[model samples]
Target: MSSSLEVVIAGGGSPGHVYPGLAIADALRARLPNVSILFAGTGRPLERHLVRAAGYNHMALPAKPAPHNPLEAVRFITDNALGFMAAAWMLREQHTSLVIGLGGYASASTVRAAVGRGIPTVLLEQNATTGRTTKWLSGMVESVCTGFKEVTPYLSPVAEVVHTGTPARPRFLKQYQQWQQQGEVVRRSREPRIVVLGGSGGAQTLNKHMPDVVSRLSEELKDWRVVHQTGEGQLQCTEDRYPSDTSQILTVSYIDELASLLFETDIVVCRAGGTTLAELALAGVPAVVVPFPDASENHQMANAEVYREAGACVVVDEWAAGDRLTDELTSKIRELAADHQRREDMSRAMRGLAHPDAADAIASRCCEILCGTDMRVAA
Candidate 1:
C-alpha cells in the first residue's frame, strides 16, 4: 500500500454520476486509512451542493457539455481547452497520482489532462450502455470499471474492463434490512403507498403527467398514499394538478432522505438512472421505469431493460405518454397494487440482482492499481 495516496474523482451533472464516485471514495477510505480523495466537479450548483453535503473536499472545473450547434461547438472547444489546462495544473499542484472519472461531460477535461500527462486514470461507467464521455476516454484510461457486464461489449478493445456493479451506500442496505424485519407489520397495513421520483432535480415530464396518473387511479386507490417529488418550481403546479381534495397524495419539491421514503413505499414510479436503479434493487422495491428519452444513446432504456428482462420492473417509454401511455401505466400500477404475489416475486428478482459488496470490490481493484498490481480483470 502506498503511504501517500491522493485521488481526484471528476464527474458531475447529476447525483447519478457523483454518488458512484463518493461510494468509491468511501470504499477507499475503509481500505486505506490515509487515502486522500477530493471531488473535482463541473462547478454546477447541484454538484457543488451535493459534494459539500457529503463533507468532501471539492474543486470545480470549468467544463461544459459537448455542443449541439456550431456556435456552441466553438465554445465547447475553448472551454475544454481551458478546463484541460486548469485540470492539468491542479493535478500537479495537488500531487495527484490517480484520476477516476465517473462519467459526464464535466469529467472530460480532467480525464483528458490526466492521460495527456501520463497519470494513471480509470473510468466508472454506470449505464448498461457506454456514456459519451466514457467512450471518448476509453482508449486512453488505464481501466474502465463498468456497472453492468452488458457494457463490456461496447467498450474499447484495448481498455481493461472490470465489471464492478454500481455501489449502493451502506446506509441504504442497513435501512432496507430494518424495513424488511418489520415486513409483517408493514404488510398488515391496509393502506398502500407508492413514490414518484423524477431524478434528483426532478423530471418535468413525470411531474406534468403524474397527477393525471394518480387521478385516474384515485377511486381504486382509496386506501392508498402517494409521495411525489416534483422538481424545484414545479411543486405548486403538481399540487394544483392533483384532483380536488386528494388527501392521499403528498407532493414536495425534493427529498433529502430517499432511503426513509423507500422504507414505506410499495412501488416506485421513477426514471431509470443508474444510481436510482441500484437503490431500488438494494431496497427490493418494484418499479415502473420511465427512461429519459433524451439520455445519451438511450442508456436509461438499456438500464431499465436489464430489470424488465429479469421480471423485476415494468418499462414505459416516455414517447408513449400522449398515446395509450397513461392507460398502460394505470393498468400496470393497478395490477401490481392488486397482486401481492406478483410484487413479491418482482422484489425477489430485484434482490437477486443486488451487488452489496460492489464498493468493496471496486475499492480492492483501486488499491491494487495504486500498488502497481494487475489492473485487468481475469478473463
Candidate 2:
C-alpha cells in the first residue's frame, strides 16, 4: 500500500447519497488508518452538515442538477464546467489515489475529472434502477458497486458491476450484528411500537397525512406507541394533528439513533430511499413503504418493488391512493400490527436480504484496486 495515498469520495444533494459514502469512508479508514479522505459534493447545507459532523473534510463543488429545459441548459453547462475544473485541481492538489462516485449529479463532475486524469475510480449505485450519472459514467469507471442486482441490466455492458449491497453506517452495522447474535426472537412483552420516517428531508405528504392515519387506528393501537420523525421544522405542525389527551404518539424532529430505535420498532411507515430500505433490511423490520412518487426516474418505486417481491414490505403509492391515502396507510399499518405471525415472516424475509458485510466488501474492493493485490479487511 502507498503511504502517500489519498482518496476522494464524491456525492451529495441528499442524505441518501451522502450516508452510504460515509459508510464506505468509515470502512476505508479502518483498514488504512493514516490515509486522508476528503468528501467532494454540492454546496447544499444538508450535505455540508453531514460530512463535517462526521469529522471528515469536505469541499463544496459548483455542481447543479441536469437541466430540464433549453433555458436552464446553458447555466447547467457553465456550472458543471466550473465544477469539473475545480475537481481536477482538487485531485491534483490532494494527489488523489482513488475517486469513488456515489451516483448523483453532484458526483458527475469529480468522477469525470478522475477518469479524464486516468485515476482509479469506482462508482456506487444505491438504486435498483441506475442513476443518470452512473449510467453515463459506468463504462469509464473501474467498477460500479451496486445495492441491488436488478440494476445490473441498466449499466453499460462493459462496466464492471459488483453486487456488494449497500454500505450502512457503523452504528447501524453494529446493531445489525447484535441482532444476528440474538436470533429471531419476537418481543411480545413490551409495547409494540410503530415508527414513521420521511427521510432526512420531511415528506410533506407524510407529515400532513400520517397523523390522521395513526389516529384512525386508535382502537387497534390502544396499547401500541407511535414515533413520528417529522424532519426539521415540521414537528410543531405534526404534533398539532395528534390528540392532546393521548400520549401514545410522540413526534420528534430527527432521530440521531435510528439503528437503536428500529430494533424496538414493530413496523415502519416510510419513504423507499435505497439507504433507508437497506437499513430496514438489516434490522429485519417489516415496513409499509410509501415511496416518494417524484423520485428521480421513479427510482424509489423501483427500490420498493425489490423489497415487495421479497415479501418484506407492502408498497403503497401515495399519489395513486389520492384522497384515500390516509385510509390506505391506516389499513396497511393495522394489518401489520394485528398479525404477529405475518410480521415475523416478513421480518425473516427482510433479514434474508441484508448484507451485513457490505461496507467491508466495498472497502476491500477499493483496497484491491488501489494496491493491485487482492485484500480483505477485518470488520
Candidate 3:
C-alpha cells in the first residue's frame, strides 16, 4: 500500500455521527501509520471541537439538512451543490484513496462526490433502521458497514453489508478491557451510581423528568447516587430540579470524560443513539433507554428495540408515556435498582452484544477494499 494514502471521513450533524468516524480514523492510523485522515462536515462548532480535539484536520462544507418543507428546498439544494463541488475538489486535491461515510446530511455530498470520482467508498450505518442518507447512497458505495445486523434488509442488495457494529473511541475500549480485568474489586469499593445522559444536546424531557424520577427512588436508592449530564446551557435549570437534600443527586452540564465515568457507573438512563448504545454495551452498564421520538426515521427507537430484545436494556417511550413519563421512568429505574440479579444479567447481556474490536474490524474492511488484501495481517 502507498504511504501517501489519504482517507476522508464524511459525517457529523451530531456527536452520534462524528464519534464513530473518529473511531474509524483512529483504527486506520493504527493499521496504516502513514495514512492521512481528514474530516469533511458542516461548520458546526461541536463537530469542529470534537475533530480538532482528536487531532485531525477538518474541512468545513456548505452542507445543510434535507428540507422539511417546500420553503427550505431551494436553500438546501444550493448549499449541498456547493458542498458537493467542494467535496469533489477535496477528494481530487488530497488524492483520497477511500471515502468513509458515517450517515447524516453532512456526509451525503462527500460520499456522492467520491462515487462520482470512482473512489473506493464505504458507508457506516449506525442504527437498526438505516438513515435516509445511507439508504440513498447504499447502491453507489462499495460497502455499507452496519452497527446492527437488522439494518441489512433496509440497504440495497447491490451493496455488500458488513455487520461491523458501532465503533467506540479507543479510550472507551481500553476502559472496557480494564473493567473486565478488575471491575468486581473496583465496583465493590464504590457506591452504586446511576448516570443520566441527555446527550451532547440536552434532551428537554430527560432534563425535566430524570431528577423527579431519581427523587422518587430516594428510599430505594439510599446507598446510591445519581449523576446527570444535562448537556450545555441547561445545567442550572437541571440542577435546580433536584431536592434540598442534594447529597444523592449531582447534575452537570457535560461530562468531559464519559468513559472514566462509565467505569464506575452501576446503571445508565440515556437516549438510544447508536453510539451511546455501543458505549453502554462496551461498559456493560445496564440501561433504561429513552429513544428520542424526533430522531430521523425513529431510528433511536429501532436501536433501543434491538437492545431490549437482547435483554440489554429497558426501553421507555417518552412520547407514549405523555404525562406518565415521570411515573414510567421511576418505575423502570426503581425496578433495575432494586433487582441486583437483573442488573447483572442485563450487564452481561450488554457486554455480550458489544463489539470491542469494531474500529479495527472497520479499519480492516476499508483497507481490504483499498488494497485487495487483509490489512490486519499486513499491519
lDDT of 2 at 141: 88
Per-residue C-alpha lDDT of model 2 across residues 1-379, encoded as one tens digit per residue: 4469799999999888899999999889989877789999996898898999998999999988878899899989999999999999999999999999988889999999999999999999888997656787899988999999999988998999999999887788888878777765545557899999998778888998888987888899989999999999999998999888898899999999999889878899999988999999988899999999988888999999999999999999978999999989988888998999999999999988898888888888898898756554444
lDDT of 3 by residue, 106-193 (tens): 9999999999999999999999997656777898888888999999888887779999999997789999889878866776588999
Higher-lDDT candidate of 1 and 3: 3
Where model 3 places Cα greater than 4 Å from the true spot, the runs are 374-379
Stretches off by above 4 angstroms in model 2 are: 68-74, 184-186, 374-379
What is residue 239's positional error in candidate 2, in angstroms? 1.2
**By descending TM-score, how would the candidates be arranged?**
3, 2, 1
Tell me how candidate 1 scores on lDDT: 0.83
Give the lowest summed-lDDT range of ten residues in model 3.
370-379
Alpha-carbon shift of residue 339 in model 3 (angstroms): 0.7
Looking at model 3, residue 250 earns an lDDT score of 82
Q: lDDT tens string, model 1, 61-155?
A: 88778688999988899988898999999999988888998887888889988998888898888889975457667978878888788898788
Query: What local lDDT score does residue 13 receive in model 1, on the 0 to 100 scale?
Result: 79
